[model samples]
Target: MALTIAGCTAPPVVAPPEPPSAPNTSADLSGIKSYLLEKTGQLKQATRALKETSDRYYALAKEANFDYTALFATQKDEVIGLIQTAREQWMVASPLYEQMEGIVAGTPSLAEFDMIMDAGASKEEDPQDPAPIDVTLPDGRVLERPGNLFGVTESTLWGTFEAFRVPGQFDFNGDGQIAFGESLPDANVLKGGVDALDEQAGELAEAARAWTPTESDAFTALVVMVPTMSEYFDSWKNSRFVSGEASTQRDFVAISRLADIQDILSSLLVVHDNISPMIRGVDTAQDDAIRRGLRDLKAFVAGVHKQESGGKRFKPEEADVLGKEAQDRADAITGQIAQMAARLGVKIEQ
Candidate 1:
């Protein structure tokens, strides 16, 4: 009887088969092109706005007899507002410029646009009264211009040029130190910096309008850009925003750096979203991983803020941690994107 019962034991109920995964779809190339065009248009507009604001600042400076104290006393609000506006525009353009680097690299015409617009330091043997570089135009004409635009403007605004040991030059005040909250550089000096920025902005806009990106170039952009971003964050963390001689005294420029990071991530997200369909079509698992990684990186970047004590500044230790985390995340994203590029049979150059 026991044997009969054992043999009669009912077969285990079979579970229903799992559902098949959805088919992946490739992204429309037209959509990506449209996004690029739209972003470039925005960048052009922002740069133009920045130029106009700078022009207004220059005009005000001219009227104020180039005296920092008199300028602040008479048109403090207007001057400060213009500077803030120009800074905001720059914050918007910086990331767009980075995003466009790969495309620019692919286009010979845009080769020197970045250096012209945002050279970090003047390429002169002497910081004061530095000679202008000669840039050959498309028509084979030479245009002489200062190497530093944004950098010079920033230095003037923060009164940090004295750190360069160029005494009595950018030192608007008689004090030995060019500390934060000190008097700004003379109106003429700031006006010249603003003029350079204005000219370069115009050139950038013209270049952006003429440039176009191929599919291969777009893929290369994704591959190259992420790693470049990691490098930028690493530099910022290690030196640009840190304490000691590397930084702008104790000013840190934390807000500016954070804003730039935010803009950069936003631009990268546009590229990611546009290319996501292609990634999904090639490999759904990889696509998911890339999206997740970018999302995490964005959240981490957004969370970063200046920790001020007495005033706005960054502690070296704290900046180092933040910078390391940002760099690591950027590197991870770059690797993940490169995987997608590989799957798509795109060759990314070193």
Candidate 2:
């Protein structure tokens, strides 16, 4: 019996099973994290490139010393280029972004919320030119300056660029009524792009909460600053305008109407900071509400039918003084914003 059992056991000796393989962390996240990190780098590079191009354009524009509206055609081309470049880059980057989302979706790195708000791809520049400026003194000394317009006009053209013009795309068709194109939302769609960047920054911020500072911190700061810049530029462009009538006609109103305009511009400068901070971080339901409130305030100030405040008419003499004061305030505001932007690595003309 012992001899039979020994022979049977010798016939079926099996090797111990091999130990299970360890999971490969690097192999599991092969393309996605890499894609996200790469795309993020592209965005950073594009931002810097766009800023440089914009600065160059602005320098050339300032040297021209032309009216605000005069360079509309040139600016249109410049802005269009900017948009095209950005679009191409984004097109390439979107997939990477999607990949990032996929990798982060079921993982520990998942964001509370993430979205990418794309602006209309077909952005174009508006044909905003300078209108004539003519003012007459009480003694009838005419001061006539051609193409001295504000906002999207020639005089403010450079300043507008300094404030809002990006390096490439310029199609302003988003303001459906302002430019030629198919139907769209309000002319304020440009603001949405700015808002989108801010939103991305917040997501990046959340990512940073669990990640390290050296990598995510700079990117988030860059993202947040983009909207801040766009807001400044958009406000500047929308606030000023040039004359439609001849100097002879404009002068009569200058004695009567210029003061009101000065007040409007000054008011814009005052509220700039208030509106900017709200949009500087992220776009949310709350931010939208704030935006609506700000818009209401703007409309209220802009829609004042009467020149009188506190039951007193702004007499021509008093209006002139007020105009001067407003101008001084505007200068101060512009100077301060310029300094702050520079400190933040934004390039604005002196």
Candidate 3:
């Protein structure tokens, strides 16, 4: 009836509809979440160690009736030992935080801790970007937004700020000469600062556990974090690590800023790796170029680190040159990521 010698209108022949294809879900960023949690757990453990050692120090000081001189006179080795232990814990906690900072600083909900822990200046130092928390000591002395926890602890332990130090210098190391960080820290201040840091670290760890990362977070982290080389280099230029004995900075003396830069970039690299598939899906050539550029940037920093390890102290002037070069590379890479994010409709959080 449908093909009646072309004299009648042909009945329509309909093909069945095909099933819908599955969603791409190309960027499975669960690894980023896992990485953050794993590192946060490790950071919490390190902070706990610092807290324990700090408490032990404070307990000994209390036993000495708040006389640090008396405490050091009678228990020099224990005091030094506790201080060293706290320092070791700080070393661990710092890099662990750096490893998580790409995610932490990029996410809106997680960004405050980055301010309180790492990048925020003191109210006095930078009212615009000051860390808004204050520390209270046992003696009722209040540090009015004295800076980021890391800065507070570092300055307190190193005796860079006079208010955070005990009355006089001590040859705690028995080297016959008092060097940097050789003086007795005011125990009350030490305990307060480290305790605050430990508390905040614990909070950050919990927050990180609760955070579910998205492609936005990964891409935003790359865009927001990858171009920070200039600031880090400025810190390195001003720090004693590069400025030598003439440096007057209160913080960043205990560790090289170069090392910190590498740690931070290493975290951003993790963020990129987790989202590379999405980038590749959008533009394979661009993804490969970004990957290569990032690796090269990191390798450039690594080259500087290797030189530092070999005792090649970079002049402060040289840091400017290096910083500019690194920043240029970083800016280029970030631009690619930003363009790709736009193409993929990934919203980079402001």
Candidate 4:
């Protein structure tokens, strides 16, 4: 045969095998649905507490003819306690509400949810700026509201309203300084805010119960949420927290924002745990990376609590380093999550 070969045999021309497709990790839709339901229940309970407390305060204020001094004399401690309770409940409910947005994106109710619960305007210099409180529904019906419930309530409770400047209005803490724990100057406005919050809470609960998340929706929720953690941290770094605006008084803004970020990260971890098996199957190293990143970010946040200046909160200069570190760690976690999403063939929407 060798002798008979007249020319060199041509090399076998085999088409290159198509590259293997990335592994598709099945989304934990059941887990997402259950978690959303659980959070919805918690939100309902928390909002109920808020509404009840607010109602009691409003009733007492009404009985007193909105006389702050009279109300303070009679039920100062009770009013203060209710305000504190409402604020605490709000803190718990707010983050869960945020998580629900990601889980229920692309649904019909999302627009309504945003309209009712959006916190974008909460931190504005003047959250009470007059705007159209009427919303045009999908059916073209007008839905009138007094104002944004959370923002209005926060402004009133925190004494950001001009009316709060009235002397002898709310001095619950007796420090002579009207601060967050004080009562609202106008009982009517506070009542309106409470009613709106209660209504919105009902709507949210209804929407959550009706929601049915698909596997794709679960994946979207996981992918979309990772980057939001950075947004929270960035807000802290670029806002009053870094510019020394929060150094003077007991600025709860920074603390509130930090707590919000922590809540978001913790929620993401819950979702991660729900899909841990799939993530492990795709790449254990990436999973480990994400876990480590989250741990580091949490540790950094914890360190910040120990760095408080003037026994109020960490000063701008003191927080600068830790804030940057937190942002970096959040970015790392986001990157790892993005990689995992890509491997799972989940398209992440901006």
TM-score ranking from best candidate downward: 3, 4, 1, 2
Q: Which stretches of candidate 4 lie over 4 Å from their true place?
A: 1-24, 73-85, 88-115, 122-148, 163-169, 173-180, 183-185, 234-255, 306-312
What are the per-model numbers of colliding residue pairs?
0, 26, 0, 0
Ranking by lDDT: 3, 4, 1, 2
Worst 10 residues of 2 by lDDT: 180-189
TM-score of each: 0.67, 0.27, 0.92, 0.71
Tell me the lDDT of model 3 at 155.
84
Which of the two, 2 or 4, has more TM-score? 4
| Model 3 misplacement above 4 A | 1-26
lDDT of each: 0.58, 0.33, 0.85, 0.60
The best candidate by lDDT is: 3
Instruction: Write candidate 4's Cα lDDT for 1-350 as tens digits.
Output: 77568567778899999999866466555676677678778777877777777778777776777677777788878777766776676666666665555554323334345545543332233355433254332223443543455656655555555542235556666788855445453555555665666677777777767777654454455556555645555455554445444432222342356655565556566666766677787898888887777667766665554453334555555556666666667667777777777877766554
lDDT of 1 by residue, 225-339 (tens): 5555455555555545455466643222424456555555665566677777778876878878877877777677666643332344567666667778877877887888887
How well does candidate 4 score on lDDT at residue 59?
Answer: 78
TM value for model 4: 0.71
Model 4, residue 60: C-alpha shift (Å): 2.1
Model 2 misplaced stretches (Cα beyond 4 Å): 1-35, 47-70, 74-76, 105-109, 116-350
lDDT-best of 3 and 4: 3
Q: Per-residue CA lDDT of candidate 3, range 1-350, in tens?
A: 55676677678999989987643536888888888889888988888888888888888988888888878888889888888877778888888888788788878889999889887889988977799788888778898889999989888887888888888658976878988788777789988898888889889888887888888878888898999899899998998889888888899888888888888888888888888877776578998999999999989998998898889989888999999999999999999999998888888888
